[model samples]
Target: MTEQRFREFKMPDVGEGLTEAEILKWYVKPGDTVTDGQVVCEVETAKAAVELPIPYDGVVHELRFPEGTTVDVGQVIISVDVAPGSGPVEAAAAPAPAPAAEPASEAAEPEGRQPVLVGYGVAQSSTKRRARKGAEVPVQEPAPAGTYYASPAAAIQGELNGHAPVAAPAAPVAPAGGARPLAKPPVRKLAKDLGVDLATVTPSGPDGIITREDVHAAVAAVSAPVAAPAPVSRETTPVAQAPVQATPVAGARETRIPVKGVRKATAAAMVGSAFTAPHVTEFVTVDVTRTMKLVEDLKSDKDMQGLRVNPLLLIAKALLVAIKRNPDVNASWDDAAQEIVLKHYVNLGIAAATPRGLIVPNIKDAHDKTLPQLAASLGELVSTAREGKTTPAAMQGGTVTITNVGVFGVDTGTPILNPGESAILAVGAIKPTPWVHKGKVKPRQVMTLALSFDHRLVDGELGSKVLADVAAILEQPKRLITWA
Candidate 1:
């Protein structure tokens, strides 16, 4: 009989330097045939949700973990049977019975490492069943001859000692009051991080599964009373009453969001940027009357038809033009090298708020793109971001960013510089306000612009010039043609 060989696929570092990812979904299951380049699962990293493709064509043998489990990099997540006609036979045969541990002096060494995809490292060691803490060792049952074992550690150790391999014990059952809370691994991790007991959290998901929302809701219920302290008489306050409300109270009085994924990463980046970079913000109120008129004109223009032509488009273009006039503003502070790295090309980032969190996916080569091309790219970027389909690669290498707080009718904000980028421009609401137009008070389209930059790399003079240039272009729409 031909020996059927199985290959294990390890979880790779999908994002740059990402050490772990939560398996959000599984596309292929055991007994399913998959081809090379076929996506097997979707995983959520700190950066984004990415689909992982299988590198080898084979019949899936096993899925090592259930969906929502956060797996470390280089850990095997799936196994595939590669030998021809092995899948049917393997499927037909029942799981091998547990083998009795027996002693033998001569055993074979473990199999050689299998070929893996590029950027994916080999597994550190053969898989082993972790011994449960404080649990009694399970008794091994003897197996019939030629029974295949599942665990490589057991198989190798058994072979080395010339004994039959032992099967791992079934997972322990939860004591009374139904099984352990049914939560996805990520939600469970979030609950653990927030010091929440899953048993106390009420499951809202279908089939009584605990969701991230449920865990967060439980946390909110716990902290709500503290947020609004109700006056209690010393005589009425009892020790037992204090512990009664430890669990989540029904009725939504508050919400506690467990920060993770994009939101968690954004928080860390913002904190680091705010503390590390000395920021200086400069504000300019521009009469964008002409810019708004130009936007209207562009909407009706033959070439600009079907494109997203708005105030943002004009604002983005104005910023690019301003950067061109003041080339020194397009740079980053390299602290390790103690130097300013001036980028010749611009990867302009647009700050987008999605359901997941805030992500800045940039347009590549913004300085090189024509007006229509820029509009198309900007539309695509916004659409992708809104759909939560922005990839990690799209968010990297941003040289400058634009945050349009104006969409929410805010006046303006001193925007924080995106980490590594020198500056970020916040656009305010454009309202018809009385302004000095040609030294005469007139109702004109007015907007506030705030530009914040890394003081280490950009001085007051350079920043003012960049902001002034942008104001000028917005005030006079014809400047785009002259400036270009």
Candidate 2:
């Protein structure tokens, strides 16, 4: 019987100085056999969650970590036991030709330095292609006289052939020189799906990389402007080409969606928040007539023209002012570390309903901004959220949140707490209703405010006081100056 060996798979630093990652999910188990290129786990980096594809085929000997554990890059997460006389150990040794059939050379190596995964081991400065099998003639495409293949594969092949890959002889270059315009990965995918040639289309991405908009523009450019189809007489009528249709692959009936961008980030965040934090919720409703009128006045003011003045803006401003007054709401409860984090500066999160899902991107240092500055920041946040371009920075370190369910015409809802923040304020719709105003029964614009907080940090009195203060500010905008 041949001897068997185990290989430890350490997580690679998948670019950026990402120190640690949260294991969002695990796709493989201790008993499951996995092949190269199969997804073994999905991990959440600081910016996004990516599915980690396996780099070797082997039986799972052990799982070093479980889901939800924070793992440092380059730490061993799993071990795989390779079958005796398997391709794995040989291919791993193949890169070091001296080690092949030389037990003496392997015995001299250090204990922890042996290569693991075959074909791809510890990266090397120099590379050589594996010799191909069977009888075959060398195939080469003529380079454009002075140009050569700069790809690593071709260069390595050239080195193995005992000659450096040389540039082709020069010729007069045409405008395009048979070179296709560059496009982004997404744009290239779009062009392939739309049957458009990127080389013939104009580019709009930075430095002439094709954008999705560019392809749409190209499609528009190629289409002839229709004049009403001239009356088709029987003599001149011709047979029409059948419209091409995409066929669904057998056994594939579901829509496939890319999970890279916001969707992935949101999922990771929600999961982290739900699982990590202990949540407690509370609610309150207030008549916000004065704040509603203040919005109208701000809209009509000459100083605030050409600006989007909305009630949510005032709610955000009020929330910031209230946070300054009650510092406890602008905090995070860190249970693991046995500490409470209190932030002096407010990272006010606005939970906006985007086409993708709920994204709570925040305004940094919101408490420092003046009314107009806050309004401008709120405007940008809303517009960016709607366009689905909210950056990761805008989504972190939220000291408090305001979810304007009012926009959806909702009266009240117990919103889930944002991941790190201690409090989330749900602002409901303002409608004209009967109310007591100036000692008289009259119609007034009224709205409900629901404040949800982590009870572990915020007590009933503290939460109620914070809720009442916000209601007082909205009920009388003049009261904000005094209460804040």
Candidate 3:
């Protein structure tokens, strides 16, 4: 008889202390051959979406949960047959009907499950998780962190002691002729957000998954203005009803989107920051024609070639220079310790608006990077955020942040401070305005900048200097070279 063995891959705690994650997608199906280090699924945690790779090379034996199902950490999500040619596909796919029960001790903590926090691998009796339900496949423990396994994955977050994980909400199914519509959670959420009836959207994707494009097409079709009534040569039947954009659905007057994932985390953080910190906002307007010119010039510079060079790049550099000049403003208030924590390094955060909501992913050691290096980092950060791939780690430990409302064509407004950070700068749209330059009123590219900081950590004098320094640098591009 051929030897048969299976390797089970459990959901690892992708982020520090995250308790669960939703299986956003699956790349492989039963009977599909997979190689080690190949991504088999993508999952969305409370933080961000990440791709999970298989560490074991084998034929996919089964998927324990369907897509859009929220799975708790340490649950076996996929099984793979390590030994090939062991049996027919039918036998491998089906679980044994009358399998023998395992000994009591064998149902202990899984080998592949990882610790959720640093210095947390020690097994305590209080945190003991009950044995999971359904089929169990034994597998080797995962390699330690700092390997490929720990990169970019987010996890479900909650208290782990004596609490059963929350049941995943039912995935919304489009009405497809009394059969369940095939669509992922994100697609369903999109359809609902757009107020487009999924039943009206045609499915063009494989396996009938209603894609985002389909939902958008449906919205476009309904939103297109009714064509003006054309002159008719012959008499046509009088229209029974007036042309309307779209017939109202039976009962969609109100939408209560469940607050979870990134949106949930953001709301909590905002409320905490708002209540805990004392915010003071200061604003200044500056002529940034020279700085804007420098942006265009840098785009042609060989050293900066192939890098993203924009006004934001120069503004970021200006902020770094200002921080360097006013080091005290880079400090955070340690409320519990009753001390101001001054940071020597700057992890400059750029506030980005995503479909999931606002997120601030920082550049580590921004104070150390050269202009070109900073530009490259900014490019990567913006691109990663737009793709919704910003990891939890990328969003942590920010010292200061910048929110550019100018991208939306809005003038500057008082921005809120990111939690644990000293300040946030808001950048407004750059426009051509009449300004006094060298004793003459000329049309100059001007912009408004607003800086909001924690009053306890940064007094008026310190905050003003930081804001003034940035304005000075923007007014004179040479200050970056002189002051930096």
Per-residue error (Å), model 2, residue 407 = 2.3
Compose the digit string of candidate 2's lDDT tens values, residues 350-435. 77654334667788899888788887888788656544445556777778888766654578887778887888988777789998
Residue 296 lDDT (model 3): 79
Residue lDDT tens for model 3, 1-484? 2224667788988888999886655666666788999888878777776778899888887666544456779867887878777655432221111111332233353444333222112221222222223323232222221111111111111112111222333334536554435665445545444444466678999987787678778767867322221322211111111111122233457323345567777889899999999999999999999998888788899999998788888899999999999999998888888999999999999887665666789999999999989989998987677556688899888999998877656778998899999999999988899999999999999999999999988999999999999999999999999998
| Position 245, candidate 1: lDDT | 16
* Count of backbone clashes, every candidate in sequence: 3, 5, 2
Give candidate 2 regions above 4 Å deviation: 1-253, 353-358, 384-389, 434-442
| 1-484: candidate 1 lDDT, tens digit per residue | 2333667788998778988776655655566788888878777778876778898888876566544345678877887777746434433221222111232122322243232332222222332222222222343433322233332212222222212243434433442553446665445445543445567777888988887678778879866322212222221011101101122334646433335567779999999999999999999998999998888899999999998888888889999999999999999988988999999999999887654567889999999999999999988986676445678999999999999877666899999999999999999988999988788999999999999999998999999999999999999989999997
Predicted structure 1: lDDT = 0.69
* Best TM-score among the predictions, by candidate number: 3
RMSD of 3: 13.4
Model 2 / residue 210 / CA error / Å: 10
